[model samples]
Target: MPHVNTTIIIGAGIAGVHAAESLRNEGYQGQIMLMDRDSQMPYDRPPLSKEWMKEESDNANILLRNPAIYEKLDIDLKLGVEVTGIDSQRKTLDTKDGSSYEWEKIILATGTSLRTLALVGDDLRGIFYLRKMDDAVAIRDHMQHVKQAVIIGAGFIGAELASTLSEMGIDVTIVERSSYPMENIVGRQASAYFLDLHKRHGVQVITEDAVTQFHGEGKVEEAITAEGRRIPCQAVMIGVGVIPNTEVSVSQLEIDQGYVVNAYGETSVSDIYAAGDCTSWPYQGASIHIEHWDHAVNHAKTVAKNIIHPQSAPYTYTPYFWSDQYHVRFQYFGHAKEWSKTVLRGSAETDAFTIFYLDAQDIVQAAFLANQPKHALPARRLIQQQKPIDTQALADVNIALKKVPRLQGESNTSV
Candidate 1:
């Protein structure tokens, strides 16, 4: 562990803020500097699609911390600053404004950028992507003159936006290339519940179809599907997905799908670490990259501890994430890259169910709970322990999650 007297953290999202806080909390007396390109204070991004977009809330309500809190914490927060280049040899980075800073250690939490559709009329006026607060505000402003909207991609953002727009009395039509919303993550069985939920809310969900082009004079007025189905809409919101922001790395750091890191959040280059959406770390025998809020917070804390204590324990927390759409909350834990079998508890039609995804070895890999958030915590433990489960017991709602039988000598604890 090289001496880290001064630390520089890039990107002021939840991960960076929490990393800075962890350094101070863990008794690191080094000078800390946090920089971000956004001019506004760091705010929560999850609410941008739901609560913040629906209501007129004060900026402070979304802020991760008050402006004065940074001053008290002795954190030099530089907002609206873009880091242009990084020189690993010099242990320094240059900003867009011709400013350079040297540091003993650097942490990258650049997060992600919203993916856009490159159709013929993609540059049209009323199309929007919801990733930041300003984007949400612009969508709300545009909604005043529009009666209908076509949302491309039925991912979490698109689904949440569909629900929000429907609640605001705007007719919403969701166009998805997959068979159902979030099919890749939650699988077909669980996704059907969300499909039904959207239908009940009066939102038209067009599945197994994609928007081939957008047509209008200047602004988006209609979306042309691949099947030649023309749907007229006054506005459009694209939520295909997001790509990790790796431009700031300047081609100097080791990169794969994302910045490659170890279980301790240490990048290939010593004294350099990364967290949040911009990193893919080793977990449960796989190199996985998670873009959820909980992973960001946990990764930051683990990285902070590893920086202060070189021999700190590796990060082993099970990945967790949740989404809110209509009146239901969907929570998931663990990662199931591939599952041989799926065991269901309760009925999806009732909108109250928990799903257990088991791998080929019959070990619980991941679990998804819809409208039943309490099972998330226990499900996480089951994944972490890699406990083999009886399929029948897993499917029985009468058998509590804690009472499920495990393999041989493995014991289940009450959660």
Candidate 2:
């Protein structure tokens, strides 16, 4: 209950940095200390596996604020330091180097880690997982001499890397454990589209496959599947998924798959907050954990506002996400777990389209679009308002998104 003056934030990635900025924007003129395990300034991680792999020089392009901005904002950044433990009672943290710091409030934005494949030969020389800038640089260098690569898992990272390698003239084979790539995400239809995209781009896509063991003497040379099939390759990149980075055991903190928090990003423990991939945020009246870049930024701002001025407003926003693959940009918003209808507004064959998921009452629950971003803005607005729209008007391909009549319903849910 003491006055909060110094706020220490762990992890200097997107969430941490943005939270600091948000705190300043919210008029929190306090002592802000940002720490990171990495030795460099906070840089963008999303581009590491894409543009960074194309040119080694791109590795230096880290997402950061101007150095003068830190001084202007009065933020003390501690790079290359690891937080060992959190003493919630004393409101202090122990650093890995046997140092400690106290704070009136704290925020944990530790993020997540790439899930490693459990198989023999996993520690071989040519086995790799692209999660950091160093990993991408190493993989790009290896690709120069490696003619073939067997990528384990076909999630976003694996699929994007496969596309990048294929563009570089490298023969890439994606060995996915699931029935289809991204089937668990955008559903079977989208997965089929990706399958054809990869195949047309000269990349082999394997499905319903599990790697029994990696076959190599001193270096990774092949991946042996459970079906006795051998995929010959020189390098292996595993992108199964990621796990939340929450190791500190605090009994007062609620945690499900991640740190459970309410709409305001508040934890059960007072003065303690969480955001980014490590926090489970309230969405659609339920706690939903998102690992998207936009969620991290938006959550940081919300947590910052709540921390600085708790009386500002409710933390509410529609969930929106996007990913750039090949020449197409896929964007999605809102939740679709219980939606009953899926309508298309544009032609999927032309690679320019939008899919809207509507509930039984004609309320838009979610909308996904490929290459068409204009509809997403309005779709997000409708979802946030829980607005009911005319089915025919929304489905009409010729009607402009804004031109559609405003949703009218006395039973619309409050955002």
Candidate 3:
């Protein structure tokens, strides 16, 4: 084993913090430093859009690890510290506080920043974007005084936030440019289910429209649509998307959709690696970037292991993500750009359904489960195998999912 004198991990989010813990568990006695700009201890992000957005929930339970764990692991956790630049040649980093740190190995897990709207009055006080815990805190504080909200996007974050606000008895009007909510990711039919879910809960959804301007004296009072229609709302939440935080890269690392990395999380430069949402890694035959809680945890484990065991197997796992809205729990596994056919299992009307997207060869490319969470794992395995599936049997709910046979392999165990 190569001797690692000291390791530095940038970004104290889930990925960076987990990397430090994994390194210690792998028997590395070297020094580990986890740094982040946020002063708060590392906390789970998923809750920020849901429970933490509510008035009752606090940060008490969202912490990823207790302070005692970091002390016991002897990990140097420096919060509220901003890393200014990285000198790849010197293998050292400079902080904004005029301090330089040297490391034998470095992991760049700097995540992402929210993409803001370029419309007029974007800097208005009540218009907000949720990305960090502090952002959520601000939104929660603002949400208390507002009776209605205008959400600018219909992505996962937008949908989840709409649901949270609706549960708080605030009227939500979701403005989406897409024809249907989550249309780009889950397809039209599945998106309709989410749209219907929101409408049933008394949330108004405006499709094929966008908010182009905010009008108010100081705080936002109304959102003007591109069609010239003015929607009155006290609060506005923008969930357009997120951009990778590559400022630290400074042309030092290759970047595409994000920081380019190999399957083992190795960047173009040696002794440097990147994981989490900031990384774009090679998958099957494509370079894919994933921004999900599970991906962060899994990628950190892979990168940490590869750092310890360079000759280990490459990182390979099916992508999985879930969203909770109202009473529906939506789960999806795998990724697909274009699928030839979509096979439906169960009844969509009853809200218990699973859709399997298949390619031209009838191989499972992706699967979306709504309210039927039990089939999530089985759907992931089908994608991993990439074997042709029985379309007829897949549509028949009477036939067990595990009993569905593959074109070349035996029947998978029934879930």
Candidate 4:
């Protein structure tokens, strides 16, 4: 292990905080400094889109860890300190508050920034974006005064927001650019199912159209679509996407839309590491980037372990994601870009279904479970094995999914 006088972590979100905690768990006694631009305590971001918007909560409610835990862990937490630049050679960083600090090692978990619309009426009132706690606080406060909401995108954030607003008795009209939103993640059929689900819940979904401009004097009174459809609403939430917050210039630090890293979470620069949404790490022999709560927690922990034992600790992460929409829980286990076949285990109308993605060899690459808690954990564990499963047993609801997977070099029969 390298002798470290101090370790400074940028971005005090889940990734940065977890990295600091995991460092202590890995038996590190060196000085650990956790810093972020936001002044508030580190909080869970996933809840902000759903529960935080639906319920009444304060800053303390969304905190990732107890306030006193940092004192016990001996972590130095610095808030509202915006890191402007990084000197990879000097092992130091500069903050917006005109303070400079040097460290033996550094980790960048800067996360992401919300992508906003740059149209003519973007600066109008009642237009918002949800990425941080402050944003959620503002949106929640505004939701009380608003009767109708027009969501510009139909991604996870958009869908979750629609569900939350609907539960709050706010009329929601979703304007999606893609006819089948999130088809890549949930598949085409499930995408259609989601559209129908929202419609059945009294959500007016306007697909194959986009908000071109807002029409109002000072406040946004109406949203004009590209197809000339005008939507009147009290509020508009934009959830197009997010851009990686990796602006610091580090010499030879490779960045392909994000800070590129290996399974070890080590960047091209030595004594410097990165994780979370701001990184593109290796997975399944290829490099990919994931932006989700589970990925941040798992990736940061793996990175923290490798920081102590750089070579021994490898991140064998099975990407996992889940969303709570209305009364149903949606979960997707593992990652898969392409698959030869898909097996459906349950009916979609019943709202308890699992769609398994398999390659040419019939090995499960990924599985999407909708309101199927019994199959989620087991599917997550078995997908990592990359073994073929009995199709007949997998499709049968009566058969246990745990017994459907065949061992290595076994016949095409369930174990």
Model 2 clash pairs are 43-63, 44-63
Give each model's clash number: 0, 2, 0, 0
- lDDT by residue for model 4 over 53-119, one digit each (tens)? 8786656788999989999999999998998888877667889989988888888899999888887
Angstrom error of the Cα, residue 63, model 3: value is 1.3
Regions more than 4 Å wrong, model 4: 1-4, 405-415
TM-score of each: 0.95, 0.94, 0.96, 0.95
Task: Give lDDT tens digits, candidate 3, residues 1-415.
Answer: 3235688999999899899999899887898999999999998899999988875567878889998899999999999999998877877889999998988888999998888879999888999889888888899888889998999999999999999999999999999998887676788889888889899999999999999999998999999998887899999999999988877774558999888999889998888899899999877688988798888898998899988888384888788899998888989898877788899899889989999998877888889999997797788888888788889998998888888978865432111
Winning model by lDDT = 3
lDDT of all predictions: 0.87, 0.81, 0.87, 0.87
> Distance (Å) between predicted and true CA of 29, model 4?
0.9
Residue lDDT tens for model 1, 1-415? 3235788999999999999989888998999999999998999988888887778565679999888888988899999999998888878889999998888989999999988878878888899988887987898889998899999998888999999899989999999998877777888888887888999999999998999998999999999999888999999999999989888774558898789999889998888899888999887777888799999999999999988997486888788899888778889998877788899998887888999888766788889988997787778878878867778988888889888888764432211
Scored by lDDT, model 1 comes in at 0.87
Instruction: Indicate the residue-level lDDT of 18 in model 1.
Output: 95
Q: RMSD to the native, candidate 1?
A: 2.6
